[model samples]
Target chain A: MPIIINLDVMMAKRKMSLNELSEKVGITLSNLSILKTGKAKAIRFSTLESICEVLDCQPGDLLEFHNKE
Target chain B: MKTQTILNIMFFLAWFVFIALLIKAGTILTTFSISWFNDMAAEKMYFDLDLSMYKSYSPIHYSLIVINKVILITAQAYVALLMTELLKGFNLKNPFNHLTVRLMEKICFSILVIWVMSIIHNAHLKALEKSVGLSAEYLDGSYLLWSALVYVLAQVFKRGVEIQTENQYTI
Candidate 1:
């Protein structure tokens, strides 16, 4: 629950809309929404690779850990 | 709206329609029986009763009636359960693979049960000097066969999910 998907922040930094990212990454807009909303339980490496390649970022830039306390 | 929520709404609507149809059928059957019974009673009063034919046909008629009701209720319950599982996806982890497998298992079990019940039902109808429509017989077999196919597909999906999860560990 403490894991964070920083897709929204990365998209903002890259000046990209969700539709643009979805088209670039070859993932559906709905799936990207799931990742952006932190609703996905897990992400495939292939999907991560696509996102990283398209956004010019490392996987670490898209994922983060936070302590509940 | 989420797919699950939409499915839940649709399921509830389907139940409402099923209940209405049941009530309508019950009313029609009751009226028919009452009229037929009165006519039979009048004939019995006026003449010496030869009750053998009536006694034989009555049980068969009753059995057919019972079978029809069972089939309707069983099918409705199956659809309702399937829709509920579909609707739960929005909140589930690994919704597509996880929920689909669960749904497929339920569907398989339901189809098997329905198929057996339907065979008994068709037999009852035949006993009553009635024939089931070709479509009805086809539906009975198709539902079960399709369920089996889906169950196999769900296993493949489950394996894919497991492989994906394992590969994540190596990375």
Candidate 2:
């Protein structure tokens, strides 16, 4: 439950908006929003790779884990 | 509209017609058997009408008639639900083709069973010295079959969503 989605951080670091990332990745805005807002129960490795490739960031930069106490 | 969308629309229209028919049938049956409708007693009530006394006369019964109407109404609801889901295929992002196919097969089988059971019930009533009013055997069978089919389809749909998620990962 504590799986961290660092999408917002990555977008800000890259000086990119959600619309720009969606357009560049060829994915719908709704899906990218789901990823960014951490509403997605799971994320696909392929999608993560695409995001990393587009943003020029490592996977660790886009995801993290937090202990649920 | 696509072929499936057109079919879905037709099915929805037919569902509406069936619902109207159900209401009409209930009203007609009640009008003709007013005494039966007014009686709240659980005991079987029989009336002897002399509409055609020249020919032999028998008492009009109410208990079985009311039961039949109730069953028919329930059957109509089941059919409406089935049609609604079929129509939903047009709007669903990833319709579960396999589940829909299986549901279609079940519906066909259920209809066949209903038809056969109704014929037998009608024949049985005719042999028992009573005019066959509508019987709910067919409707009851159809409702049960469709309810089961819907339950199974829901499970299949859940699995399909999971599969879609997995495919996204592999891509």
Candidate 3:
């Protein structure tokens, strides 16, 4: 849980909606929402690659690390 | 035949047998039957509980016999019903769900109850040897190990359900 997903920020910077990103990344809206909400247990390299390509951003730009304390 | 069909057939048969046993236990059928100590084998291999001793039909004696049969039959019926539920899990889309795991644990618990009842019934028979004129000599407690195995299997199923949930949530 310390690894937070900042997919919403990247999507906003790219000026793309969840539906648009999902359509371009070839993933379902629900799955994209899961990634955006930090509910996904894991992200496949292929899926990450597709999302990065669609959003024009690196994996690090979409993910962040934080300490609970 | 499909596995679900087979399981359903088995469940119905078990339920039917349980109902038959229940009827038999609820009635006075055993009182009139001739129970003998042996089948007249050369070595006198077996003994049966003779209920014909109460020719006058003492209410207390008749009730005792009925209660004993009812207890044993009820335990058997409960075990059969548990097995039916266990079989039902296999027909589900996801057999390793929480409900299935709970059902498996209930089956293990029911088997333990049957095992404990058998031991208690044996003990009662031993205690009543002087009055009843018959007793069971040996106690076959093999089901305890089986119950332990079933309990372990239920735990494994619980773990499986956890893994399945995690996999589903992994997206």
| lDDT score, candidate 3, position B32 | 33
Per-residue accuracy of model 3 over A1-69 as CA lDDT, tens digit each: 899989989988989999988889898998888888888888888988998898888989988899999
- Which 10-residue span in candidate 1 chain B carries the lowest summed lDDT? B42-51
Error of 3 at B157 (Å): 1.3
Docking quality of model 2: it rates as: incorrect
Error of 1 at B169 (Å): 2.9
Model 3 residue B149 CA deviation in Å: 2.2
Q: Which scores greater on TM-score, model 1 or model 2?
A: 2
lDDT of 2 by residue, B119-152 (tens): 5544444543444332222223354455466656
Q: What is the DockQ of each candidate?
A: 0.05, 0.12, 0.53
| lDDT score at residue A64, model 3, on the 0-100 scale | 89
Per-residue lDDT for B1-171 in model 3, tens only? 487788789888877877876665544333333222222221221125344433223435534544555676676777777676667556456778877788778878877886887677566556656676643344466878988999999999999998887776664
Give Cα-based local distance difference scores for all models: 0.64, 0.59, 0.70
* Interface RMS for model 2: 4.6
TM-score of chain A of 1: 0.96
Clashes of each: 1, 0, 0
Q: Write down the RMSD of candidate 1 (Cα, Å).
A: 11.8
lDDT of 2 at B112: 49
